[model samples]
Structures are given as C-alpha cells and as structure tokens.
Target: MRLDERIVPYLHMAGLYHLVRLNETWFRSDESLVSAFMERWRPETHMFHMPFGKCTITLQDMAYQLGLPIDGNYVSGCLMDFERYIKGGHPAWMRFEELLGVLPLANCIDKFTVKCSWMQETFGKLPHGVNDATVKRYARAYTMMLLGTQLFGDKFGTCLHIR
Candidate 1:
C-alpha cells in the first residue's frame, strides 16, 4: 500500500479518539496512551485560533506576533487529509476503530463509534470527486468544530475540551 493508504486508517482512528475526548468524557485511564498517540500523530506545527471573547487575532494578524509567514496551507493540509480518508473508505474506518481500542478509556468505544457515524453522514453529502473547494469546506468545518467544542467544554467544565 502507498504511504497515504497506510496512514489513512491511523488518521481515522485518531480523529475518532479526538471526537470522543471532545464529547465530555474523561479518558483518565487512557490519558498517557492518548497523549503518546497524539504526540506521534499530531502535526509538528503550532495552531492557534482567536477565542470568541476579548481576543483579537486573525490569521493574517498572527503573522506579526509570530514574526513568521503564517501560511494557511497548514490548515489546508488538515482538511486535505480528511478528504483523502473519506474517499478511501472502509480501511480507514477499520484502522480508526482499531486505534480507538488501544486507548484504555471505557466509554470511548461508543463515543468514537458515534463520531464515525457522524463523519460518514457528513462525508456522504460531499462531492465524490475531490477538489479544492470540497477540501476547503471540509477543513473549515473541521476547524470550526474544534473551536466550538473547546469553547463549550471550557464553559461546562467538562474534560472534553482540547487542552
């Protein structure tokens, strides 16, 4: 299999695990394992989004703060990965479930399964053929979901929020 093909399953599993953690369940048991997996799979680049209140930071504005060219391409790659996985289908889901099982979180199994259901539904509506537009939309949605979930978790005092 191609590298992309091999990685797709891992990505799907990671995505599902992420979704479960974001759903307000504390994966206390699997914390270390999850952390290790995240450290391995997460992008090396730093990502920051402006909070909803009392913050002013645009992607363009952040450039001055970082003193580096803030390329939007990093976000683009995230979305592209999602698109590629969706197009690849079953092997991706299988890999994702397998990875989810590696974590010691008990409740996570069901939560991750549900996340896969949501992803499948959302992906089914997209254009079968991949294109820049579809990828961008997927990326934007993914980013927004992350932001909203984090904010929600903070207000509710749940462990679901991204750290």
Candidate 2:
C-alpha cells in the first residue's frame, strides 16, 4: 500500500517496476479450482492429468500472464558460495542485522529466515522527508519481499531467507 513513487526509478533500474505495479491491482482466485488442479497434478511428470488431456503451464504462459519479459540474461549461480564466504568469517546474522537494521524473531525463524509479515511491518511505511539512502534501502527491502513472495516462493510459505 505504500507506493512511495520515489522507488519507481529504483525498481525500474532493477527491472521490477512492473511486478510492483501488480501489487496495486486486484487478483481473484478460486480455492476449489486450485485444489482441483493440485489434486490432478503429477509432480513426476510436471503435468496435470485433466479429464480432457495432460497439460502443463509453460514458462512462456507464466511470463505472458505475469507481464514479465521473456528475454533477459540467463541468471545462473548458487548462493552456496556466498553463504560459505559469509560463514567463513563474517557473522551471517550480524551482517543481516546490519543491513536490515532488525533481527528476526527467534520463535518464528530458522537460519537466516524472516517472516514476510515482519518485512511488511518493518518497511511497509516510509518516513516523511527521508533521504536517498533510506529510499534505496526501502526499495531493496521491497524488491526482496517481491522476489521472496511472488517470484520464488517455496515450501516455507510465509518465511523467506534473509541471506
């Protein structure tokens, strides 16, 4: 709900303004329909055995539906190396705290994980008359939330890796 507009340029620079815009729009979903699909899904084949035929949603379909660009530099890498480096000397949680200016609650987290609600609570509102640095920080946090919740959501559901 906090579309500060100041973050527009930052989001644009990072190639994520379109995704952030989607947050403003209303999207309706049917739980029963989704449950039906889930029931018909064959994870081994990555397809749905519907009554009519086998079907699978392709990346192209998702890209089109989500208004995402199809062509971009292929992103390939692992965070394992970065995590190793971080663990070697730099304290992971300390670094995370330094960057985000907050610590995850112990009861709700394992490893460098924070709840999405915590992110919304912490950075959902921007302070009045803040400087460029603060705006950039907010933009970074917003991008992280978008990626964690929208693009790369996993079994963790509401929790996301802070690293």
| Pairs in clash, predicted candidate 1 | 13-96
| Clash pairs detected, candidate 2 | none
Q: Residue 85 in model 2: shift from native, Å? A: 8.0
lDDT of 2 by residue, 1-163 (tens): 3767887899899878888745636554454776677789897999999999999999899788887777877654456654555654677777776666667678757666778877888889889899988888888788878878666654444777765
> Per-candidate RMSD vs. true structure?
15.9, 3.7
Q: Please, what is the TM-score per model?
A: 0.24, 0.70
lDDT tens digits by residue: candidate 1, 1-163: 0112223343354343233343345433355654443344423333222234233346676445333345444533343344354434544435444433222234433432223224324532434466655444454334334444432222222223111
Error of 1 at 133 (Å): 35
Shift of residue 50 alpha carbon in model 1, Å: 14
Candidate 1, residue 105: lDDT: 36
Error of 2 at 20 (Å): 2.2
Q: 61, model 1: CA deviation in Å?
A: 3.2
